[model samples]
Target: MQIKVDAEGDDAAAHDLYYWLRQDRELRRHAKADLTQAAEASDRMNAGEIINMFVSNGLAAASLLVNIVVAWRAARPSPQGTVTFDRDGTTVTVHDTSEETLRRVVDLLASAPPGGASGATDTGESSASSGSGNR
Candidate 1:
């Protein structure tokens, strides 16, 4: 399974995430993670660096989703923007670091089939939505 992480115009933030994942011993052992630059021939709209990760062994990609959030929260300035996690066609965006947002996303990803993304929202789970909520 492949998980594409885009910082959504935040290349610096993406680079930070790419390196953060690289620094993880467990992630390195279980998956093939690489940083990608926009193809030279690609159009402007698609231009930017994205991290492409391929899951091969023991890692549950969904569970590791928290790592991205963790990394974002660890940022010194903490990006005032969002990061997008795209799997197949289902995209779950992390808007801000909030417990409600975190749980909602965890539930959404966990409920889906392995290697699949189900864009479902839990009405009972309240999010800051200031930067959280389904996009």
Candidate 2:
């Protein structure tokens, strides 16, 4: 005998009807086990998104903390001192940490054009143009 049934809404009622029709104990147990496994897999899938959100939020907080430290350092005034050193066998280096030097560097950058000192022209050529000819 063939029975035509449309099991759409009310899952509990549908499952009860299905159980009544399939009187075999082993079949019912197998069906229940499959449903349980599917439910667990679906739960894990939902939990993955929550875990990803937590990780992203933690990274964002760390990035914000780093930015705060950088801003604090930049706001502090530097000492007016100059240091000269030689390293790497034979290379000489001089570092000027004076306020005057910092001011000059800041002024130079402020006066520079948007793209840079070598501004771009309509023809896409650099203003501070230099080319190495075949020579």
Candidate 3:
């Protein structure tokens, strides 16, 4: 999958690793346990070390999440906007493509000349109308 990590910038390998971790129940359980242990250990460790460890672990987790999201996005065709999937029951949700963007894109396409491409269409549609109207 063509995963695009914002910080890592196209870290497909890292994304695959995270996907594997998520799919494998054993690995997921182990990772959860490890995170918990590390969090607990942070309290007993020196202040500097604890802070460093906490930050590092948090960043790692965040990076993993970014990669997974990118991978999931790539897996789907025509993902309208930011998409999320639930591991249980295979539910998917899309967000982040604000009504403004949707309206602008729709207006852009609608204003195009027959058999011609246009790029200068105005995009000032109101959110209430754009969102409430059926496409």
Candidate 4:
């Protein structure tokens, strides 16, 4: 037979089944013997075969972990701070000022347009707009 897993709802059940299967004495003995033989054979294996085996096992384990994590994440609802935006008519605005400075800048930017310029004077030093030439 075949086993089907409803990974989201039956994760605990699947783990219990796995434990039960692994606990079978005959199966465990066979597995242990196979592992011992493989270890001995691995000593005789060429460097390439040894490296390939190690890489394959590592990749398989990593793939399994990644799949489980992705499934678990998918099964749960996303929390706040995970922002979603529309494909159209949605704009992201970023300001790199401190909270107080950001608030003031936002207020200033909101009140005036680019070239109209507000807040600081033109001393040839960088103002926010002139620095980027957004004006």
Candidate 5:
């Protein structure tokens, strides 16, 4: 997956925020665990056998359901624009689109709090990240 962040604020603050996100150990650990589990699950799926007609139909149905769910999520409407962060009474919204920025945002959000944001919150703007299975 990829992450994209855009911030409207001081260059130094944005860079520092990104750095802090990268150094967060919990985020890194969770991201590693998630990737590992996905890899393991992918490895365990064995698609070589079609035991009988019923089994084949069941597999096909399951695949269809999975595809449908993915499609539904893709079609769902989500908030658009940059994630806003409030630091020391200053509101900073992230909008960076660089590869490194994406990686950092992904890693940070992977293990962020349920709200997808942390730290200062006073601007009433959401500086949240998006992900699941985070601790």
Candidate 6:
């Protein structure tokens, strides 16, 4: 599965997440993740950019990603904001990084599609962009 993570819709936040995920042992083991740069300056490292990840183990990989993201969100000084995880057709935007909230994300990603594949949501009272679309 391919995952695109955007942090608070901010490029810097996305880059922050990219570097953070890079350092995660479990995440590194599960997926090959990288930061997406501008079309013009692809050589230089883009600090504030989206993160793209490819995983072979589907839900397990997504779960590891969310776990790392939740920890990263908590470690921030303040204003945790939100992070959106888009995989397949499911979009989960998280405001509160609680266990329950993160679980919802995992559930959505793991959900069975009409056929045999598709996916998962957040625990936040702010329900705006989280969608369980067909994968």
The prediction achieving the highest TM-score against the true structure is 6
lDDT of 6 by residue, 8-100 (tens): 334366667778889988878878887765454222223435567766546887688778877887777646666655655556667676555
User: 34-108, model 2: which lDDT tens digit per residue?
Assistant: 111122323212221110001111333323322322233233344211111111111111123233433332232
Better of 1 and 6 by TM-score: 6
- For candidate 6, the TM-score is 0.64
> What lDDT would each prediction earn against the true structure?
0.53, 0.24, 0.30, 0.25, 0.29, 0.60
Candidate 1 global TM-score: 0.59
How many clashes show up per model?
0, 0, 0, 0, 10, 3
Give the runs in model 3 whose Cα sits over 4 Å from its true position. 1-21, 24-57, 83-135
User: How big is the positional error of residue 109 in model 1, measured in Å on the Cα after superposition?
Assistant: 5.1
- Give candidate 4 misplaced runs (Cα > 4 Å): 1-4, 32-135
- Overall local distance difference test of candidate 1: 0.53
Q: Write the per-residue lDDT of candidate 1 for residues 93-126, one digit (tens) a residue.
A: 5566667666655554445433443333333322
Q: What is the TM-score of each candidate against the true structure?
A: 0.59, 0.17, 0.25, 0.19, 0.22, 0.64
Candidate 5 lDDT over 1-135, as tens digits, reads 211222223223223333443444543432221111112212112211111111111233323322322233233244223433222233323343333433433333333333434443333333433343111
Q: Rate residue 131 of model 3 by lDDT.
A: 42
Of the two candidates 5 and 6, the one with more favorable TM-score, higher being better, is 6
lDDT per residue as tens, model 4, 61-88 = 3233223323333443421011011111
Better of 2 and 5 by TM-score: 5
Query: Who wins the lDDT comparison?
Result: 6
lDDT of 6 at 83: 66
RMSD in angstroms between candidate 5 and the native structure over all alpha carbons: 21.2
Error of 6 at 81 (Å): 1.1
How are the candidates ranked when ordered by lDDT, highest leading?
6, 1, 3, 5, 4, 2
Estimate candidate 6's alpha-carbon lDDT, on a 0 to 1 scale.
Answer: 0.60
